[model samples]
Target: MKWSEISIHTTQEAVEPISNILHEAGASGVVIEDPEDLVKERTSVYGEIYQLDPNDYPEEGVIVKAYLPVTSFLGETVEEIKVGINNLITYDIDLGHNRVSISEVNEEEWATAWKKYYKPVKISEKITITPTWEDYEPVSSDEVIIELDPGMAFGTGTHPTTVMCLQAIEKYITQGDHVIDVGTGSGVLSIAAAQLGAANVEAFDLDEVAVTSARLNVKLNKVASTVTVGQNNLLEGIEGPVDVIVGNLLAEIILLFVPDAARVLKKDGYFITSGIIQGKKNDVKQSLLQAGFEIVETLEMEDWVAIIAKNSADTKEG
Candidate 1:
């Protein structure tokens, strides 16, 4: 079978939404090529060598690629995707170059096309994200290694938003903390918390695919004993009162759960939120403040923001 390669030149903020649009349009999977990776310094600490080519990335913004079977309705599907992408602007999402391109390739080519774009990288000082197919070794005694296979789910454990959440986890998670990972795509954050010695961790995602993928990743990380993956909308019905709550979700979705997060979060508990575009940074911060959270710190990478806050509700369940 042949496939049409649909590639969008867009902003980091629009990557998730556009990727969703493509998925809904019947794309088998999506590949993201962000220019930031070109300059990312990777280590061969495990003696595994991989090289990245600059031409594979756009000079600015990012290129999101997806594969759709070449069919009679291919044109209609592309049009629908275009319309969906354009509609995002009404919601205040930046489209960057707003360029879309299409190409044709065989199924075999499409299968291996994305592999060249993914590689192991040291996302944080102590954390390294290596793809499941790669061989890597710890460079230091304190290094944390995450083996991930994104598998059409969102979290690669290297995206800026996810990376920020992992970094926050390493710093704020107590040795025996009970943690909740909201919208835990691929369960990367949950697995990270579990590996970090979290006594218990709950991974929640509304998408069934994400739930299954997260469960597999959690097991792959050998943290099934500590981390549990489930499907749930936001923080609804989450009986938390936990030490740490983290969500890497869109700013709008994050706003919807701020109040709920504050409700379940124990007094002095930590809240880490990411997947926020730079433009919506303040809106999310204000929402958190309104929900009885004190802003601890804000981290920025590329064009994304991650906010760490502390629940100041003054009510401890225990």
Candidate 2:
């Protein structure tokens, strides 16, 4: 078998959305090569091992790589991916160079090569995400391990937005609480909510591929019975009164559904929003305020932000 590696040279801010585009186009595996990783500090407390080669990364911007099988429809798929990425500009996302390239490789070589970049890294006080191929044991009695196979998913569940969202979920979710995960890519948050003792979880994604990948991951993490994966736009047709609502999506998308989020959440329930850039922090905060949510806490990681807001009892349902 042969695989074609599609590489996109773009900005760090564009990585998540561009990766989503590739995943939607039937990419088998996605790998991100950010130049920042070369000089970024890693703490041993989190058990992160950094063995990155500078040569593998671009001098500027970020390079996102994905593997697709060489097929008759390969060219059309690539063109569609390009169009999808270009469409992102309307959202005010920075694309940087936005150059794309492709190369062919042997299946055996490509399958195992990208695995070296992923290792068990503790993302929070209680949660550590490890690749499915790695054998990792919990170092403490309270530690929780999430095993993910990124080859079939959108991300490795270790991005800053995801980490902050998971940490917020761990902090707020109560035992047997009902949680709803909006834009539930890879179903990581839904799985975590269940693992943390949530009685039930509703996970949703707009992309059918993401819905499929997330369901696969929920089963892989052995939480399928507790977490339900489906396809739906953010907060649309969801009648909650759920204990918690979490979304890790672009700030613009988050803004679009703030009122719906407020309506579905139980009074005093938490809304955890991530994938927001630092500059857009104030905008999200204001939206949450208008939607009758009181800002509870704000979390920052690098240039990304995650906000935890509480839906007030006074919030009116339209």
Candidate 3:
């Protein structure tokens, strides 16, 4: 089998949405090559970690890559991907050059090459996310290592929003807490919650591919009993008062679940929301407030924002 590597030259702001477009186009996986990884100041936690070659990254913008099957409709698929990328501009996403190119590769190369792009990334003060192939040892006894393959799922636990969400989880999750990881891509957060001592963790995603990926990761991380992965759209149909609910989702999707989140959390229970771009920060904050949540803290990393709120009282899931 052969695959076509679709590479797009774009800005960091458009990375998430564009990646989604590729996934919807039937791409097996996505790879991001951002120049910011070189000089973004990770001296504290990652500590001389990035060894990326400058030549591989564009000096000015980011490159997003994905692999799709070289099928009878390959050309049509590529054209559709281009059209989807062009559509992003209407949503105010800067595409930079938006230069897209395609190249052919063998099955072996596509299966193994992308793995080189992933490594042990120390995402937070106490968390280090390592891929399964990488041999990583804990730098400190307190350091928690999350091994993930990611596969076709979006969450690698390294995105700014995800990192902030994990940090928020570290700050708020209590022992024996029943936690719901809404939009839990790759089950990374659910695994983290279980490791952090949550007795029960429900990892939910609407996408079946993500559900399969999350379930695999949860089992691989030896948290099968502690974490349960399922398909659910945001917080819909979820019941029971959970002690903590964490979602790393788009600002619009986050808004959809804010009211439901409030209704399903116990009084004083925490809601840690991420995946919000800076532009939608106020909208999300306002929605959270309107839903009876009191914003306790706001965390920002790069151009993303994560809001930590608390449900003031117990309410039924409506």
Considering only N, C-alpha and C atoms within 3 Å, which residue pairs clash in candidate 2? none
lDDT (tens digit, per residue) of candidate 3 on 89-196:
776777999999999999898788677667678877777888888889898988878888878843223778878888899899989999999988778899999998
Clash number for candidate 3: 0
Clashing pairs in 3: none
Q: Return the top candidate by lDDT.
A: 2
Candidate 1: regions farther than 4 A off: 23-26, 40-50, 69-80, 153-157, 315-318
Residue-level error in angstroms, candidate 2, position 289: 0.6
**Native-structure RMSD, model 3:** 2.1
Give the residue spans of candidate 2 off by over 4 A.
Answer: 42-49, 154-157, 314-318
Better of 2 and 3 by lDDT: 2
Backbone Cα, N, C clashes tallied per candidate: 0, 0, 0
lDDT of 3 at 121: 81
TM-score of each model, paired residue for residue: 0.88, 0.93, 0.93
